[model samples]
Target: GAISYVSFGYINKSVQPISINGVQPTENNVKNNKWKIWSYEHIYTRGKPTGLTKKFLTYLKNDHIQTTLFNKLGYISV
Candidate 1:
């Protein structure tokens, strides 16, 4: 078997079977900085975001969307 580092979202969305050989991290692991692999999404703008960009940022910050990212997409909230 080979070891690979990937985001939880990738694993969750995978179409094929993935065998996890070791213990998976819990929320506590994230809080305590025990988990090493982290993924981030960033948006860069010349100035403050506005219009559709602002709306999109707001939408991503919504509680419901965050929950969905965790429950359905397997992404840990930061």
Candidate 2:
């Protein structure tokens, strides 16, 4: 909610974020399987990605980019 408020006005205080079982929804917890309520996101390419497409994909998958940009933008990295 904090992240969303800062990024966009999409959070509703009346709607609380929930946990799965006893696990809280955190980055490390979710990544390590301590919590599990996520679905896989897929990107499809015709044939193979090349040139700018490949470069953009590589940049998106980079660790620093994932941590700084994607995470900050409320996107989960794969």
* TM-score of every candidate: 0.67, 0.68
The list of candidate 2 runs beyond 4 A from truth reads 1-15
Best by lDDT: 2
Cα lDDT tens digits for candidate 1, 1-78: 446776665554343324334434555565565654455756687799999999988888889988786557767664
lDDT of each: 0.64, 0.65
The candidate 2 region of ten consecutive residues with least summed lDDT is 2-11
Residue 71 CA displacement from its true place in model 2, Å: 1.1
